[model samples]
Structure formats: C-alpha cells, structure tokens
Target: MAQSTRRRFLLAGAAAAGALVVGWGALPPRQRLNTAVPLALDGGAVALNGWVALAADNTVTVVVPRAEMGQGVHTALPMLVAEELDMPLARVRIAAAPPDKIYANIAAIRDALPFHPDDTGNTQAFARWTLAKVARELGISLTGGSTSVKDAWLPMREAGAAARGMLVAAAARAWGVAPDGIRTADGELFHDASGRRATYGSFAAAAASENPGDAILKEPHAFRLIGRAVPRRDARTRVDGTARFGIDARPEGMVYAALRMAPALGATIAGTNAAGVLRLPGVLSVIDISNAFSWRLAGHDGAPAGVAVVARTFWQAKTAAEAHAIRWDAGPHAELSSDGIHDDLRAALDGTEHHVYFAQGDVADAQAHGRTIDAEYSAPFLAHAAMEPVNCTAQVADGKVRLWLSTQAPSIAIGIAAAVAGVDREQVELHEHLLGGGFGRRLEGDMVAQAVAIARECRGLPVQMIWTREQDLRHDAYRPAAVARLAATLDAAGTIKSWDFIGAGGALTDHFLRRNLGLPGAGPDKTTVEGAYDMQYAIPHQRIAHAAVASAVPLGNWRSVGHSFNAFFKESFIDEVAHAAGKDPVAFRRAMLLGHPRHVAVLDAAVRAAGTPPAGRAHGVALHHSFGAIVAQVAEVSVHDGAIRVHRVVCAIDCGLAVNPGHVAQQMESAVAFGLTAALEGAITVAGGAVQQSNFGDYPVLRMGQVPHVDTVIVLSGEPPEGVGEPGVPPVAPAVANAVFRLTGQRLRSLPLRLA
Candidate 1:
C-alpha cells in the first residue's frame, strides 16, 4: 500500500481504538482557562483565566507560555491579547505561564503529521484532528518547532476577548444598560447614552462575577495592535543586561560545579582519583555521578556519564574537575568515526528495505521514458552551537526539587528532573529563565537531569553545574547526518515528469520519543523525509522514502529539523534538474508551482526584490515550505580566491499573516545567518566514538563579516498566522549552494560546500 494510504489506515485503526477509551475522541480540547491554582493575584490584580491578569492600575499582563529566545515572542504573544482587549501594545506586560496542559504545543504535533501541505484530503484532516486531541491530553508543554506564535494565535486572543466582554458586561450591569451598548478602547469602557466612562480596573471585582459566554474574536481588519510592529517587551531588559539567563541564576546559598564527562559518546568512568581532586583549593568534593542515568534503562542513547567537582567558584570547580584523573570504558563504539557513519548511511541506502513516505501516480512508468538526472547529496552532523554553554542549577530539600534553568520544553524538563531527583512531578519547582540561544539545544532534558543528580549530593545546598565550551560541543546531541539520492526525469517539454528522493539517516523522531516519552516509535517518521516528501511542487509522479540507520550518536532537532538538510538536498537537486533541462531555475520552480499561488507569490517577490545581481555576482533561487510557511530565497554569490561569499540574500515569506512583520523580518535575517554558518563551515565530526571538534577553533560559526546582507519581504497574507522562526532556515543553504553553482559552474553536492 502507498504510504499515505497506510498512514490513513493506521490513524483510522488508532482512532477507533482511542474512541472506545477516550469517548469517541471527537471532543474539543481540554479547558485552557481554568488552572488548579488561580493566578497569584496581588495589589488588586484580577485573574482572568490562565492567560490574562488585570491590575487596579489598569495594567494588562499576558501569560506567554513560550520561551523568549530572541525571537520576540515576549512581544508578539502579547500583541495577540492587546489587539483583542483594545489595549495599547506598550501598556501590556508579559509573564511566563506555569507548565500546564493548556500551554501544550498541539500545533507542533499536528503539524508533524506525515502529510503533504497540499494533502488536505479527508484522511489527513481527520488524522490531524485526532492527533491534536491526543496532544492536548498528553500536555507536553514545549517551545520549539516555531510553534509559539501559531499555537497562541487563537487562545491568547480569546483570553483577551473574554476579559473584554466580561469588563463590558460588568459595566452594563453597573449602569443598568445592555452589554452591547458598551464600547471598549484603551482599557476604558464607554457608554455614550449615559455619558458613563470607567476603567476596566474599576470593574475588576464585578467583571469577575460576569460570565463571558463564547466571546467573539475580532476580525483581522479590526486588529489594532496586531499586524503592527512594536518594540519587543523585553528589549530594555536585554539591552541593559538586566535580563536573567540560566547562567545568571544566583541563589542565596548556591555553589558551583564543573563536570568532566567521559571522552566518548557512550563511555563511562571505570575509576577516578576523587581524593586528589578534592584537595584542590576551594574544591568542596568530587561526586562520581556516572551511575545517575542509565541510557539503556531509560531507552535513551548517548547520554554521557561524568564526575563533577563542586567548589566555591565556577573557575575553581572547573580547575579541579579537569585536573582529576579517570579511566573510561569507551564501550563498543570506541572505534566509531565520521567515515564509518557515512559508510553506514551509504550501506543503508543500498538495502532494499525502505519506508516509502509519499507516493503518487506511477513513478516507475514515468521514469522509463523521460530524460533523467540523478544526484547524491550529503550533509554532515552539526552541533546546535548555541551561544550559551549547557548549565543548570538545582536544589533538593525536604523531598522537593527546585530548578533554575533555560529549557525549550518545561514539561519535559520537569518530568526528567522529577525522575532524577526521585520526586513526583508536582513536587518539583522549575524556574525558567531567558535563553542566550536555543536553536534546539535546550529541548533535551539531559542538562536538567544531570544538574539534579549533582545537587542531590550537595547536602541540601543548591548546585549550579556548568559545562565548558569544549564539553558542551563534545557532549551535544548533534543534528543527525543525512545522505540522499535524488533522481528526476524531465519530459520533452522540459517539465518534470517524475521525481524520486530517498534519504537515509538516524531517525531523530524515534530517538526523541524513546528518550523523552519512552514511547516506541513505530511506522514511518514524518521528520525523516519531511522537506522532500512535503514539497509543494505539483509533480505528477513522485516517491519519497527514508531508511533509518541505527547510530550511537546522540541526535536532536536542529533549527529546521529534517527541513534543515533535506532542503539542501531537494532544492539543490531541483536546481540540477532545471539546468539539465536547459531552463532557468526560477522558471522551472514556477512551472511546478502553478497550483500553489502562495508559493508562486513568494518566489516572485524574492526574485523581484533580488532584482539583477551586481557585476561579478550570480543569483540563485530556492523555495521551500515548512511549518505551514512558504519561504523563497534568492542568494547573490561571488567566489573570491576560490572562497564562496554570499553577498546578499533576498527572502520572501508567506507565513500566513505575520503577527509582527518587523520581527518576522528579523527572524529571516537570523535564520539566513545561521543557515550560512552551516552551509559554509558547520560540521560535527566523530572519532573514536567521541566528537572530534570541541570548541570554536575547530567548529566555527559565521562571522559578522561573512554574514550576508539579508533583505526580507513578507508577502501580505490573510491566511492564519504560521511560524517564521524555522521556515526561513530551510532554503538558505540551498540558495547559497545554487548561487555558487551558478557562479563557479561547480556542483557542490556535499555540505560545507567546499570549492574544489
């Protein structure tokens, strides 16, 4: 059976079984407004559901459930509420929401369903609906996948609307007038007939008594604060250095700890000189925590075991930890190398077994007649390389665990911490801080778990564990390396008649589910073949497959997940097919996107904005759709002394309606710089089962001078808002690679696109 058909059948079977237990599974999501504990109100603050709090001073606070990782989510999420409540954006304050089922990332999971963006058939729609309900029940509160804005679009607005209606109703009751007669603007409710005006704060007590029944959201045209660019709410704090990142956490009695992990991916300590390490100045004790977490027992992989030195200061702890001598058991993977992993992927591709992700029409028959073009592309494993190294602070007292850290998934972090601390989830208190960078590094709970284990030996004192930059990179859950073989056939008319893309790599989703949820990952993973299978191009005969190869390397989601590398594969191959057919790259893509107006619009916008490349530079274009957003990028490139330099990148995005156009543009620019770093120099190599590149010297990032001047054009869209954070990243590498091909006539099929 075709993959799509098989997926539908499985979903149907699961839905049938779920309905028997979950009462038909068609119920709406669980209530998002009510919390077990009410919002901690003070100074005449009125709690309105789980999201909004109104104070007697007429201040509005919107609870942002997502992390503020420089994406301006602290500002953009509040805009959703301010627009509905008729409040000025500048007057709104932001608060991080406590971990709850209400803040679960239903959109992320629903978006992860193995269906093409254009596949809106009944089966896919039903599967999405069912998955969303299940996601709500699971309540995995996460803040990755560019899901913040898209997930909050409806709920936050409704919270504001409900509060607005309640305030209006409260005023109507006070004045003996109909609720419909009250108008709200700038935090004031007005009644023209009676000439009565009052602040929403004045009616806070009464509004709490009034019921807002099915409050209506404002139409797009009625939006006041949304669709307008406002300064980020946390900008001032960040600028003045008042913003507290995880590293900035300083508790009253906190000590410092430095970890010296095993020198290999799955190694453990055999022996250590604890007494000598403890003799170092300011060194409190050496705690051997190698047995704290068992990857096999936890169904996890590549969680490094280590010994930590607790001391008076971070530097002292680091000095002591590094000086300690230890013998390690490197295990079976001691001889693993990057070359070995590459060969493993190639061997997997040679196998006959594969999971077909998407298939349409008869690709074999179509491929038999047309002119064919085949290419193989590979991208090396990459580290998240977040600016902040891994660190976490934890304290265990009175059978309770308290943590201070930056995490992408608080619910998951809490769960991991609870387990490590041997406490119940509710007994754990997580204080989330701002992240210096999370591209996806903070998503894993390993850091939190390790910190909790270290703190357990601190005798009721809080311990802040910090990893050196070398340790951070070496022990990172690297992005999975992937290899793809793509073959496409063009008809006599220079139009693609058949397209096939088969990829092989470690399946990140399986690894993630096993490590995080302990759920067995069966069936085809959408992430393994996402960017290739979900292409918006209208290929009549197409097949996309993926063969998962087992690996000991710790894998995690990167900036764009599968789209990160797959776009480089699919789009670059598309460029090859275009050239082979003697057609312009943009024209070739445009021809395939006739049925996709949003894609065509973005491509046209990017092309128009890019215009003609300056002398000595060539422009290359690529388009990709991910996270319900379509982004097209045109890169201007020049090779100077055999070094590829991206001069400028013009990006156009149709991310539904951008919640904040300015922030959207900033994200595009950030994504381009990040993607360029990977395209030009990012790679995480392994030797003897350990990461070979430890710090920036071996693993370099894109320098400021190397960053291209990015121009973003957001196509005016009326569709519901989608994500902007990751959508811009997918097309960047391919765009640059294609531009280099255009300039140098060299097809760089491998990543870090070295010029030969």
Candidate 2:
C-alpha cells in the first residue's frame, strides 16, 4: 500500500473509534461501569482454569501471572508447576495469564494492611480479612512487592499436580491397573507391572474427564526441579532478541506518538501552538491528551498534563514534540521546593499528631530513667528510572478498546483504559508484554490511561506513545522524601533501655489507591512506616510512629519503597546508639536479637562471609527482614580524599527454601548494585514544583567501574519461599553508610552519604 492510502485507512479507523465514543456517551451511566468478569479462554487448547493450559501434543503450558522484568520470575514461577508434574523445565512451555481473580496477588495486599508483622489480634485479623476479600473480589492482579513466586507457590503446584494425577488415573483406567501403580515420568504415564506405557498426549481426552483426588504436593526431599539452579525460560529469547517487550508491539497502520507534558506535578495545560509542529516531517496530528475532569477524579499523580504529536515514526514524533510550544499552569505548588519539603517534615516531627504502629513498655518512663542519645536523618526523593521509558500502545475502534503494554497491574489497567476511553470495562482487551524493567514504576495505571485518552482522539487509529527519557524522569511517582528523628536510652551497663522513633513523610494512602486502582482510600497507610515500624530487633521499651506531613510531590513505590531509605535512618541510628554506649555494632545488634534465630542466623552468616576488614578498610553491618525474608549485608569500604569507595559487599539471606540458589544469588547481586547507586548518588530534588534532574547524566546509576563485588550466601531453610527481588535492597545502603562511618568517624545519618 502507498503511504497516502495507508494514512487514509488509519484516519477512517480513527474516525470510527471517535463515533463509537460519541455513541457510548449517549448510553446510560450505569452501562458505562460493568463488573469485571473472569477469563474465557479461546483456541483449541484445553484451558484448566486460569493458571494452566494443556494441548493434545503433551505440551504443558503454565500460565505466569507475573511480569518478567529481568528478575527471573519468568523461570522461578514455572519451576513451581513443572516440579509438581515431575517434568524437566525444558518439557514445559510458559505463557502469560489472562487478567482474572484466579491470578490475583493475594499475599501482598494482605501484607499491606496496617499491622505489625507480629500482630495477631482481632483488629489485625479483621483488617487482613477485609483486604483479602477486596483483593479476591476485585481480582487485584499485580506483579510487584516481590510476591510473584510466593503467591504462585502453592496454587501453581497444585494445578500441575492435579493435572498429573488425572493423567495417571486415565492411564490406569485404560490399562486395568490401580491408579497408584501407574507412575508418570517426563510427560508419559506408565505401569511397570504390565509393561504398559503411553505418552500423556494419548490420554489427554480421558485425563480431562478423570477425577483425581486432592493433589498431594511433593515434599522438598522428593523435589526434582524446585530447588535447583534451572536456567531461565526467557534467557535464550532475551539474548537473541526474540523476546517481545512492550516496545516491540507494532500494530498494523500504527502511528507513533511523542508527548510534552506540564513540567510541574499536578499542573495542567493552559494552551498550545501546534501550527509549526504539524509542518515538520512525518507529523500527522497534534492531539491534547490531558483530560482535566478525569485527571481530577482519578486523583493519580504523574499523569501530568500533556500534548501528544502523532507521526510516522517515534523519532519524527519526538523531534516535532521538542518544537511544540505550550503554556503550563504551575498552580499552587509553584513554591513547594525540596528544601522546604524537608524542613516541613522536620517541623511536623514535633507536631502533636502521631500514629504509633509499634509500642512496648512506657517509652517516656524508660527515657526518664536512662541516659538518652538522639540523632536526626533524612533521605531525598528517588525516581524509578526503569530502563524502558514509559510507553503504551492502544487501538480504539467500534466501541471497544485494545491495549498492549508492559504493566504490573493489568486488572487496574483494563479498568483505567476503558473508563478513560468512555467505554464499558468489558469492552476493553489488554495484551500484556514483557517489561523492559519495572522496579515498581509499572505498578501504576497512568501510562495505560494516558495512552487510551490519546487513542480516543485518534478517531479509530492505532497509536503507540513512547515518552522521552526526560519525560519519564521528570514525571514519575517519586519515592517520598523523608525525615526521621531517633532516640535511644542506654543503661549503666550499656544495654539499650528504650527506643523512640518518629518518621515524617508524604503519606502513601492516597498514592496507594491511585496506583493500585485509580481510586482513593482513607485511614493510615502501612507503607508509610513499613521499614521503620517492622524491625525485629528486641528493644525493650520502644515506640515507633509516623507523622504524616503535607506535600504534593507525586510519590509512589520505589524499589524497596519505605525500606529503601528507612533502613538508612533506622539501622544507622542503631549504629549510633551502639557507638555512643561503647559497644561493638554487630555485638550490640546480636544481643537485641536473642529469640529471632532466623534473623540471627543471616547476620552470623554475613559476618562470617565478610570476616574482618583490614586496618585500611572499615566495615559496616546491617540486618533487615522484609517480605518474609531476612537479609544481612556487611560492606567493606575505604575513604580517601573525602571520596568513599565501596570495595565489597557480603550478603546473606534466608528467604526460606531457595527456589533456585543461583537466581537468589543473582537477585542479591542486582539489589546491591541498585541500592549502592542510591547510597552513593541517588537523589531527586524538586524546585518550583518541577523535577531538577531529567536523565542519567544528572541522576546517574552505579556504573560498572563503581559497582562493588557482591558475595552472596543463600541460607537453606525449611520454611516456605519468600521474596528475593526486594528483600536484599533494604540492608545495602545502611551497610555502606555504617562502613563509611567506621572509616571516616563521621556518622552519616542521611542517604547518599556525604562526608565533611
């Protein structure tokens, strides 16, 4: 087809979509909001609910509900299913799951409810149940919080095991033998007594009808694939460029889009001059993607007001966008700067209102009896800065909408797109692609909504919008800048008598709702004080509280979220108290963790792995438990001419039954690289309600030369598997800071530890 003819075809499709939207607006309001339904599978394959699908060719396909962003989840989850079926990883195929309640992430939501990890009271139980109910009903399918494996651990295994049992039962019926006498191996059912063997493919029809008793999952000792270092399913495809990432989604008659948004957070477009931009090469149309009415109702940040320039290619769109002129409303937040944010948080620490998440004996009485040591700490806001800049593809035609993107929360994305496009939720179809990298940024539905909003203007055309790196960095739901005040009372013998911790920051409640569901919620957010309040150290008289301050900075989950910086504040303060009382930091922490053997074990392993830093090098130690995993990190550092160089990090983790020990070690290494970058140079400052840094030039990651050698030790345990992706992140920054303090004698309480 010629270019002109193709353009006309796309224009006609766009017009059809526009007409559908107009028709949709005439329908009753009740019709626009439809209840979400479960998955209805297509194709000739046998659909076993939502997590497993089988073909007659003995191709066992396990449906993964998690997004693969280079964390090895694509392989880790497959192990759970393949292990139960007693099949090699090579024999099974992996597929993306449809958005359904059967795939909802039930664990993370339960963990998010406001309660200490140790809480078991009625209030806690009630909150947990309420959260669980909401998750199950809404089908809250997401892939973050290091929960993919844990959530899939039991269910995936059972699904596969049950299918395996049915195959054996079918073979037994056909061969006139007891089901117990039929053994299955490598996708085949066999009976040794009768010397009868048949491929699982031959029994597929009967197996689907056979009733297998309750699936008894394999024990650890009998496991063939769960614990081994199996290669990732996506490894070969990734290396050979065969993997289809979000950026690779190219729809027919697709036109590219490049966006220029309001520079300030929570700002809107006042006007634009698009005449000259349209004259540029390949520029198709200039469309205003910002929906002021819906943006206000959605209450989501990082959906900054923007104008999109659709063109023949991304480069054409991007080049034309750079020249487009626009006036932005900086709004009431024009004066909100980073320095002011910190000062306000610091001041709020002294305010009367504080919600304590954890408490023990009377902290006031303990402080009155013992000598107290106090310290203040702060951390700058951080950006997700994922490798793939925010992008989405959408096609709206004939009263229906289609979306293809790399997203963590597809259920939320489906609703967000349909609502934004003025279509019914049931009319939306979402095709999830592999994420280039998420790091918690993709958890929000902003990009999905933004794309649909733009696509609606395309008449019935298919549009793919790819944000520039600057656009991505400048408009992100940042990690909230925080301030912390910590105090410890020491007895005569240098024993810790009391602990008081007050953390003040931008609240996570509103952002949690917006990012999770494009809605709003009330009550205290557990994420606000997650790392600060949930430490397992056995301080006798302790009080941990969070002071919610006011800030309009767009805040969302970054890497470890609260733990990303709170670990620096809490663990570094503990080191200060240890030093103030003339005690060794490691031994001081050891004394406090008497009953916590799991925590103690990781700490001891980290210490042994690190041994001792030489006289020229200083060591810092930190232990943190998160996502039901305990990680201990020891950093060896040397400071010379006021520059700190981290030489090595010895990390020990007990994530319970390491699914793949090699992958666990790899994740730890990745986390150290991620955390060290933040510890050394990560910061996102706001000035005049706009972000200060735009790209890697200013907000740099740890380069290869700067990255330290990470020695990883995975502790074997009997408990169920926990999170490996995020648990390793919390302890790294503090370990580096403690090491710096030991070397320089300057207690660095703040993040991106600077020396004087």
Candidate 3:
C-alpha cells in the first residue's frame, strides 16, 4: 500500500481503539456521540509507532515525526531507531513522518499542566490526566519546546526494537530455530550452531507478517550508539549543498511571489495601482491577501495586512513589489515606539493587583524584617532571524493542496492550508523540507496560507512564495521584550529570607494558546511565569507574579523561550545578593541550591573545570535549569579597549544521559553562538511601529574572531536525557555577564552588555 493509505489505516484503527477506551459506556448515548474523536494513524498500528524498511540494496529508511532545524533531531533520533533495529548507521535513511496524534509530544502536555509533582493528587494520575487532555486538544502531538528527543526517546527506540523482534521472529521461522537462539549483529541475524544467517533486507518482507514482540529495551550498559559520538546523518548532504531547503524546492511550472506587508501592523490597503503593476514584465498577478487573526488575537495594531506580487521569479516579484505604488491606512498603533512600550509595561507592573502563578510562605511578612535589595532588569525585543528567510511552496488545484516548506508544526501547517483552501484535511499534504534554522519562527502557518493563495491564483500551477531578507526580518513574529523587578530580603547571616519577583511582558501564554495549543482566551499564560516560579533555590519565602501588556510588535518563542530573560533576571539577582553579602558568587549559588544535587553537580563541574584563572583573568559562574535539564557555565574574561573580552568558557551540562556525545557537543557550540549573538549585539528596536534594524549589519551575530575557545563537559547522571538544544542557551548570557561584572566591578543587569 502507498504511504498515505497505510497511514490512514493506522490512524483509523488507533482512533477506534482509543474511543472504545475513553467512552466505555460512561457517557449517555447523545454525549457519547458528541465526545471528541481521537485521530488515528495508518497501518492499523497505534501506541507510538514508527517503521524501518530495508530495501534489497541494504538501504534502511527510518521515519521520524520530529522536525529537523539544526537541533540534530534528524541525526540523534535516528541513532536511537537504528541502534534498536541493530542496523549500521551508514545504511540508515531518514524520512519525516506524516502528521498524526500518535506522534504528539507528551512533554508539551506536561508543560501545560497546573499540577506539579508536589501537588495533592497522585503524580502518575496527574500525568495521565494532563496527557489525555493534551492529546484531545493538540490533535497531532509533535515538536516544540526542545522535547523532540526526550519525547521520542522511548517510543522511537521501542519501534526499532519491535521491528528487530519481528525480523528475528521471521528469521527463526525461516531457519526452523528457536527465536531465543537467534543472535543479531551488524544487520545480520546468525545462528552459529545451525550455521544459518541472513541479512535483514532478505527477511524484511517476511518479518512484516509476524506479530511484533515486546523486547526489553537495552540498558545504558549495553548501548553501542546511544552514548558514543556519531556524525550527523545529513551533515554530508548539508555541507555539500545537496540538501534542499524551502527556497530550493521548485515544482514544474512553479512561479515565485514576493509580498510587501503593510509597514504598520493591522493596516489595510487604502488603494493600489494594480493596473500599472500588471504591465511589468514577468509579473503574473498582484493579490490582496486578507489578514486573518482568528488563530491569534489581533495585536494593538492588528494582523499583518498586505499585498502580494506573484511573478516568474523571486527577483521579478520583488522588483515589481518595490515599484508598485500602494497607499496604506496606518492602524491604531502608528505612533507606538519601543520607549512607549517600556513605559506601558512599567505602568502595568505598577498595578496593585497582579496575577500570581506561584507562591510559597508569606513574602510580605518576610520582607518586613530584614535588609532588602531591589533592582529592575530589562531585555529588548528579538527576532528569530533564521538563516533561510521565510518561504513556502504550494500546489493548489481543484480543492487539493500540497505544501513544501520547513515548518516546526507540520500538522498545524496542513490544517491551516486545508482551512484556507476550503478543502478536507486529507486533501492538504505537507512535505517537510530541511530548515536552514527555525528558532521558533517556522511554527507560524501564515507563509503556508500565502503560498496556497498564490497557487490558487495561478490556476493550479505550483507557486513558491519567497520572502526577501528585508520582508522576513521586518514581518517576523518577534521574541517579546520584558522588564522584571526582583526584591529580596537577606538576614544577618547573608541568607536569603524572602524573594518576590514581578515581571511585565508581552503574553507568551496567550500566544501559545492561539498558535500551538489551539485554545482561546486561556488566562494568564504560564510560560511567562515559569522560570520565576520554578526557581531551584531553597528559599524560605518566595512569590512570583506577572502582568501582560499589549504591544503592537509581534512576540513569540525564541530559542529558550521565557527562560532566556528569566535566567538573566534570576541569576543576576542572585549575584547581586552574593555581592551584598560579600560572599563568593559561586559559593553563594552553591549555598542556595543545597537540596538540588543536579544543580550543584553542574555548578561544581563548571567551577572545577574552569580552575584558577591567571592573575588578569576574572571568572564568573551561572547555573540554570530549563527543559528538564540543568546547565552551568563559567566564563573567564579580561577587559581591554572598552570591550569585555572573553578568553575561555567552561560549560557543564547534566541532561540525564548523553545520547550522542558528538551531537550534544555540536548543540552546545551552536547554543553558545546563538546566545552570544543575543548577548553581544542582538536587539530588535521599534520606532513609530517600524523595526529599526534590518539584516546582519545592525542586528549582528557573533563573529568567529570574537568567539572564545569553548570547553564543554557533559556530566553523566544516568538519568533520562531531558533536553540539549535550549538548556545550553540560558546559562551563557548570565555567565558572560557575571564575568564582565567580576572584571569591572559593575553590575550589568541588562543584556548585550556595553562596557564604557
């Protein structure tokens, strides 16, 4: 059977099974009919399924449900699948799987839950409830939150083991030997006593018939590929310029499109001279794309209202768009500026009543007795700035649509395209392409809709809608800027008595509800409140609250999400507390993290790895926990020429078990570059509702000459691997900032620290 048909069969079977279990005579006849239906997978298989097909030529294809955007999921995830299947890594070929609920990420569900491990109910019961609700709402469980590897850690491995089990069973049946007697190694099943052996490819078809067995997964001790350094499977293709990104995809008779969105958010086209633009060479059509905000709330200025230019080539469309004379009616936020936004957020925080996400003991009472220290820190708005600018290719014909794009949320992309094109979800197909980099921008489906619109306008001819670098940077959903106020009380012994954190920022929770979770009007988003509430300190009294301030600028998840700002806030405050107490910064953090061994382990490892710096070198340490992983970084710095020069950085991460040491190291290196860019020169400032910086000239990335030699230490706790991509980001900023503070005796509260 074809892949699509097989996938549908599996989904239908899984849905029926899930419905029987969920509805089980508990509801009335009418209620049972109205209950939410579960999404089914193809091939009549359920419960976290994947397949490995070995062709006669020894080419092994492993299907994955996650998106690959430089996170190395394409490499790391397949390593698990291949190892469990007992196949050589060199023979494995990776394919992105179809969208299905079976692949929905369980970690995002856990993130949405209100119940903590210390909550009243049984932890397992809470987990079950959280996951079921997530499955019902998300429709398709998939990527986001750097949970791809952790979520797939078990299921993908199990699928491989089960496939191996089936192959062994088939081999045993063919050789007329006991299944237990069959031994496998290097893709070959052998029975030394009987002198019978067969390659997996020879038995793949026969293996498809046998019932898959539930073999226990290999322990860490038995792992051959899990902990070892393995080169990325797609590295050769990527480096050789053979891997196709969204911009590289070109269907037959495909045309290109360039769009000029309204300079002001929520503005509409008052008038346009389409008649003049239609005469331009290579210009096929000028489309007035509608602004839809049903999925997300309209910002202060509103949706990205605009016009699109479709042409024979991207440059043609771009040229035509530039030449087109269009007038825009600026919306309500015409006068909005970055300084005005700062004032508005500060005003919001001044409110007496705030939404409290987490509180322990009485912060007000503790604040009254001891000496108190207070400070405010702020971070500027940030853009995703992915290497490959936003682009999506679509072929829409007779109510059938297909999308080729690099998207983190393929299920949502398909659903949005289907809805916009007025077609059944089945008719809308999504082909996952290699993303140059996502950061989080690819999660939005607007580009998918734009491509579909251009395709529909071209009479079913495929259209590859591409955004210019300027358009991509200006029209991006930005990382929200934030302002935080931290107040703490210290006793005479220099111990923290009370901690109160109040922050004001754009609504991350609101965005998550609209974009990913598909929930509307979910109050007081928890993402903005997470890092503050979940601080890994042994404080006697603590309270964390957040207030949301509406802004004209678009805001969404960046690399580390809220933790990026919160780590800067929390860690900087901790350093402040240490300074007030005249204690060593590392010792101060170590004292507060008395109960959390993993946090201490990373801190200890980073410090010891850093060792004693030379006389001129100053050391700074920071520890942060995010995505279920704890990381600590130590930076050694020397100041010269009014610049903070970092000589070396020592990073230690304890993410349970290191799946692939090489991949982990690469992620750390990438994370350092990502975070350093943000720390040194990353900022998206708006003046009069327009992004001020364009391209790398103003918004700079870290250059090779400025980057210090980084040393990484992965501490193995034998715990389950949590996350590697984003956890590495949170610590670097604070570590570097703290090092700067040590060198100059100046407390730098804000990011992109400037030395004067």
**CA deviation > 4 Å runs, candidate 2:** 1-44, 120-130, 292-302
Worst 10 residues of 3 by lDDT: 28-37
Residue 141 lDDT, candidate 2, scale 0-100: 83
Top-TM-score candidate index: 1
What TM value does model 3 have?
Answer: 0.91
* Candidates, ranked, TM-score: 1, 2, 3
User: For residues 86-108, what per-residue lDDT tens digits would candidate 1 score against the true structure?
Assistant: 88876788877786788888998
Candidates, ranked, lDDT: 1, 2, 3
What lDDT would each prediction earn against the true structure? 0.87, 0.82, 0.77
Which pairs clash in the backbone of model 2? 13-460, 14-459, 14-460, 14-461, 15-460
Which candidate number has the best lDDT?
1
TM-score of each: 0.98, 0.93, 0.91
lDDT of 1 at 191: 97
